[model samples]
Target: MSKDAFAAAALALTAAAENGSNMCLSFLNALPVTHAAISTLGAPFGSETICASDSQAARLEELQIDFGAGPCWDALRTRAPVVDADLSEPTESAWSLLREAIRDTGILSLYSFPLAIGELNVGALDLYATTRAALNLPLIARASALADLAATPVARQVIRRLPHLDTDDTNPATYSRREVHQATGMIIAQMRVNADDAQALLRAHAFTLGRPVREVAADVVARRIKFTRDDVVDRD
Candidate 1:
């Protein structure tokens, strides 16, 4: 892709972010794929298809979430691009169930790029091609770059959906609270997740218990609440 084209794509994504438009379409218009989808996977945001160019694209994401394996999962886990250039002659056996599920979907190629901000593993942006095709190194790099640009807006969209989070608060103190930061670090150390995921976990736990996030953070800081990989334990 030319620099001009890349700039145009970025502008389109910016417009979508500002107007609440479907951002996935920007990928379809800019990339070589026929379909595209963006999703939030795992904790903090949970698993959800935020946008898809078509039903098949949405189904692909759904299948990945259901089976717990797919290019999207792999991309997010490894923080790298995953490309099954020829799905009919799959290069890897990691997503057996996903391969079977998408067999007759006329999707001959699939690509996934991890979305993240620093160490925060957000989710993935997936692209699908109905005909056997490969994204060369340059295209892969471009897609990855675009995915990086898309992560912030996608994260914002998910964060806005959290009932307990006040996105409109401009008070820096609300975000810079000492207890919250301490609790987040504790969760990161306990669960082996990124800072963003750790914070989201705190908010999620607080939301579940109908308590203020600060209170939950205080509990965690006080060692009255513990976070495990599988569950949150109240030491109190």
Candidate 2:
């Protein structure tokens, strides 16, 4: 891509993060790779969210969350470069399921790069390739730099989107736990019930479903799905 195109994509990423959508995620509609995500953050801290350059990469991340193993996990755990080369070629026999899935999708290589926001381990950006060498060092360096630049908008978006918690409050509880509270509040407002009553209902639903309260809250807020007396914790 041209430098101008790179700049425009980066700007779009910033805007998306500011919108409380996702942090530094952009979908490269056309590329040799299947997908990519950038973490607009540093290490020793928590990530704002997940960002992807394409949908396939996004699916991989989601699958990783479900499977608990993949480039995303390796990237976050080691903070180093991960390469799958090709799903048909595996380093070991253990990742059979992952390998099969990638093969079905025609994704040949994978890379997940860590994004740090100051001292925090903000999050990771993932990339999918049709070949092993799709990401050169220069591209990795550029993506890393872009992730570093995206932190500002991510922070701004967090504050703007969640007003109940103090914006300056670095308490992850406010960010995570309070996310549950915020969702509960929205549900309460919608149902025209008391805050305590709403909290009880949501908490009960989350516990029954075996999901984290914050995650439940997010579902409620996004309206991607709904909750009910018989609702179980929905794991994605």
Candidate 3:
């Protein structure tokens, strides 16, 4: 892609940061693919399509979510891009079911990029072409960059929907305090997520409750809150 295309993508994604509905369209405008989709997979957000450039793109994401497997799932699991430049060839073992499911869909190529920030596994960005095509190194790199940019706002959009809880507020400066670090460690142990993901969970919980992140960290440190893979437990 040309520099102008990347610049356009940046602008479109910036707008998408505010209005998430435009995210897939933004990717479509920037890439060489025929369709695009943005989806959140598992935890905190659950697996669902956030947006798709067209019905075919939406169906592709829905199939992955239904079968619990696809390039998108692989992209997130490996935290790397998944590219199948020619769908006509034999499917990889990991994608057998998804390949069979999509065989009649007229898709000739597929690409997926993981959307992540720190330890938070937000979701994926998927692109597909109806006609045979390959994404060269530069295009893949640009797609990865766009996916990275999309992760934060996508996470925030999901976090904002949680029910707000009443809590004491603290200074934003306390976000970097020792207690915050300790609390993040506790969450890591509790949730089995990475340090970055643990901290993101803490910050997201604080945002949902309309409190300073430090206050939430303090609660975790005090054992007033406990995180589990399935839920956040209040020990109050």
> Best-fitting candidate, measured by lDDT?
1
Tens digits of per-residue lDDT, candidate 2, 121-149, equal 34566777777667666666665556555
TM agreement with the true structure for every prediction: 0.71, 0.52, 0.73
Worst 10 residues of 1 by lDDT: 166-175
For model 1, the stretches where C-alpha displacement exceeds 4 angstroms are 90-92, 166-236
Q: Model 2, which residues run further than 4 Å from truth?
A: 1-5, 19-31, 37-55, 93-96, 151-236
* Each prediction's whole-model lDDT (CA): 0.80, 0.55, 0.80
Candidate with better lDDT, 1 vs 3:
1
* Candidate 3, run of 10 with poorest lDDT: 165-174
- Arrange candidates by TM-score, descending: 3, 1, 2
- Ranking of all candidate structures by their lDDT, best first: 1, 3, 2
Better of 1 and 2 by lDDT: 1
lDDT of 1: 0.80
In every candidate, how many clashes are there?
Answer: 0, 17, 0
**Best by the TM-score measure:** 3
Q: Compute the lDDT of residue 223 as modeled in candidate 1.
A: 95
